[model samples]
Target chain A: MIEEREIHKEYEIKENPLVDVAAYLFLEDIADKQGAAGMNNYLISLATSLAKSMPEEEYKTWEDFVESLEKGESIISTFESVRAKTNHCMVTHKCPFERGWKEYTKRIGDFARVHKEVADYYNSTVKPGVNDTQCIICQTFRAAAAERITVAKKRLKYAQLAAVAPDGSKKIAPDEWKPILLEKAGVTNTDLNMVLRNNACIWILY
Target chain B: MLDVALVSLIQDMSEKAGVEGTIQYWERVGESLAMRMGKEAYMGWPSFNVALREGRTAYSIEGDVTPLTDLAVTDVDGDVVGYIYALKTCVFEPTMQRVRYSVGDVPQADAAVAEEYNNSVKDTAICNFCVIHQKFREEVAKNITVADQPLECVQLADRGFKGETKIARDSLKRIGINPEYVRSLLRNYACVFAILMKGARLKGEEEVEE
Candidate 1:
C-alpha cells in the first residue's frame, strides 16, 4: 500500500505557495468588484472562452481531454483517478487557489475585503469573530475553478456528438451544456454545492 | 530567531487569529528584539564603510552578535531591484529545525495546525532565523533608492540553502568582493541567509551599447 506520507510528499513537491498567493489575490480583486454571483458568472465565462479557444482535436476523447487539461498552465497539480467504474469517472487534484486563500487567512487572519454578499454568506455559515479555514471566499474560487472541468467535459461530449453525426446537422448549444454535464455526472445542485464548499478537489464526470 | 516561548505564543496566536495576525504580531516581536540587540545591531552605510576601511569588501561582523550581510539583487536588465541580508552563523537553527520537524508530527486531524506551523516556520526561516528579524529588511528597503527611483513592494523571498551559493556569489561579484574571504565563508557557513525584496522597474531605460 502507498503510505500516506508518500502521497503528502507528492503534494508537497507540487505545492507552489507563491502561485497560491497570486491566485488568492486575484480572487479577492474580482470578488471586490463583483458580487459572489457575478464572480461565479465571470469564472464560467472565462472557462468557456478558454475552452472555445482550445484546439478541438485535442479533446476528442475523455482521456485526451484529461491529458490536455493537465498540461494547461492554470492547473496547479496532476490529477489522480479516485474512481473509474463503468460510466463513472472521478478525479481529484489540489487547487492552489484554495490553498492560497487558506494560507492567506491563516497568516493575515482576516478575509480580503470582498463584496458584502460574499462576506455575508461566509458570516452566516461561520461563527462571528472567528477566522478558521471554513472559508466561503475560497469555496467561491474553488467552484469557479471547477467550471474549467465542466467546460472541458462539455467540449468532449460535443466532440463525441460530432463524431457520431459527421453531417453536423445536430448540435448542442453552449448554454445547454451545464445541465447536460451535471446530469451525466449524476450530480444534483445540492451535491455540487456540498462538493464546492467542502471537497473542492474531487470532480465527478461521465 | 525567536525563543521557544515566543514561538509557542506565535503558534498559538496563529491557531486563533491566522497567519496574517501572526505576521503582524511578529513585527512587534522584531521591534522588541531589535531594541534588545542594542544600537550596534542597527546596520547603516557606516557599517559598510567600516568594512571597506578594514580592507573587507563584504560586510563582516564577529562575536555572538547577529551578522547582517547586505546583498543587492538585480533584475534581468541588471538594475538593482532590492536588497537582501545574509545572517551568518544562525543561532536559532535548532529551534527552526524543531519547529519544522514538529509540522510532520502534527496529527492528520489537525491539518490546519500543521499548515500554520509550516508557514510560521517558513516566515522565520526566510529571515535566516536571525535575531535581527524580517522587519529590518523592510526598514532598510524603505530607505534605499536605485537610480533615483525609490524601491516599492519590498517582499521576502524563500530562505533555503538551495540557491544561496549562486545568489551570494552573484551579489559578491557585483561589488568586486574578496574571493578568498567569500570562499571561506561559504565553505564554513553554507549560505544560510534569507533573501528579501522583489524586482523594481526603473522609470527610464538607458540604451546600452552592445
Candidate 2:
C-alpha cells in the first residue's frame, strides 16, 4: 500500500478530489464520442483502475461503477485474442488433473461442488456492463444458433418439392448436386449441406 | 540486357494483340513476373517501384487496407518488385477520409496505465483497441476536426505502441535493413502502426468502450 502511494506520489498524484472529478469527466467526454463507441468494453476496462478515484452518485449505479473498477481479471489483450479460444480456467481448478472421486457417494458430491463453483464464478465475475454483451462464448453460440434456426425455417419451403426419405425423415439437404460439384472442384474441407444452409442465400463457386 | 529482351517481347506481343491496351496490360504482367524473379535477374531493367513515395493518402497509396486489396510496387519495367499493403489493423477504423499509416510506436501498445491524468479528453486519441473499418477510411479529410484544427489525418499508431512491418526489408533489400531485425510475416499478420483514413462529420457522441 505504501509502495503504491509512493508510486502515485512520484507521478504527483495525491488523493485530490478535483483531480478525481476532472479525470472521470474526461472519461465521460471520450465515452460520449460516437467514433470511439466501437471499442470493446473489456478493452476500456484495462484502464478502469484510473476511475477508482471516481466518487459514487455520479453514475446510474454506484455498485456497477465500483464493480467495473476491479481490474486484472481479464489479462488477455485484444491482440493476444487473434483466434477464437475459450478460457475455462475457473472450473478447471476445482477439477484436479488425473484426480476424481473413486468412492460412489464422494463422486456425487464432487460433481455438485464443481457445478456450484462454475455457477458462483460466473455470478461473481460477469460484469454488469457492455462487457457482457461482447462475451465471446455468447456471441459465438448466438451466431451459430441464429444460423441453424434460419436454415431450419428456410428448409420448410423445399419440403413440398422433395419426397420424404425411406425412413420417413425429411431430407434437409439435396445430396445429388453438391457432391458432383465438390468432386469436380476437388474441394472437401466444407460440407455442402452445412455451407449452403448456413453460409449464404445465393450459391456460386469461382 | 534484360530490358532489351523485355521491350522486344512487349513489342512482339503488341503487334499481334491490339497495341493500345495489351501493351500496358502485358507490361504489368511482365513486371510482376520480373519482380517474382527477384531484383538480381532484372539487373538491366528499369525500376518503377514507389515503395517509399511521398504525398499520397492511404486511399491512393494502396486503395484499401482490407485484405485481398493488392498494392503493387514495381520497377521502371513495370515489374512488381514489392507489395505495399494496408495491414489488417485498419479493420477497426472507419474508412471515411483520406489517410495514411506509419510505423514505429512499440512502447505505446505496451503502456497499460498512463500516469498523470491531464483531465483533458482530447488526449485519449490513443486508439489502442479502436477499430476503423472501410467506411471510416473513406471519410473526407476536411471533415475531421479537433480543437478547431483540421484533423485531416488521425493516426491510431501515433499515440500508442507502434506497428512494425518487414515488407520493405524483404522486398527493397537495398534499403540495407538487417533481415534478422525485420519481422517475418506469417499469414499476412504484420504489425501495422496505423491506417490513415478519410475523416467524416461527427455528431459528437462516442465512447472508447462500446
- Please give the CA lDDT of all the candidate structures: 0.35, 0.24
User: If you assessed candidate 2 against the hidden native complex, which CAPRI class would it receive?
Assistant: incorrect
For candidate 2, the TM-score is 0.18
> Please, what are the lDDT tens digits per residue for candidate 1 over residues A1-206?
23643544344334433223323343444455666655544443433332332223323466655544444322212222233221432323233234444544443345544533553444354322112222222233223334444433463221110000111112111335546645666656455445434332333334
Task: Work out the TM-score per prediction.
Answer: 0.33, 0.18
Model 2 chain A: worst 10 consecutive residues (lDDT sum): A88-97
> Looking at model 2, what is the TM-score of chain A?
0.19
The C-alpha local distance difference test score for the whole of candidate 2 amounts to 0.24
DockQ of predicted candidate 1: 0.01
Q: For model 2, how does the per-residue alpha-carbon lDDT over A1-206 read when each residue is reduced to its tens digit? A: 45643442232211212112222222223234422332223213322321211211222442332222221111111001111111110101111101111111221122222222322333244321111211222222222222222121231010111112111222222355545534533434254333333221111111
Cα lDDT for residue B101, model 2?
Answer: 12
Report how far residue A48 has shifted in candidate 1, in Å: 5.9
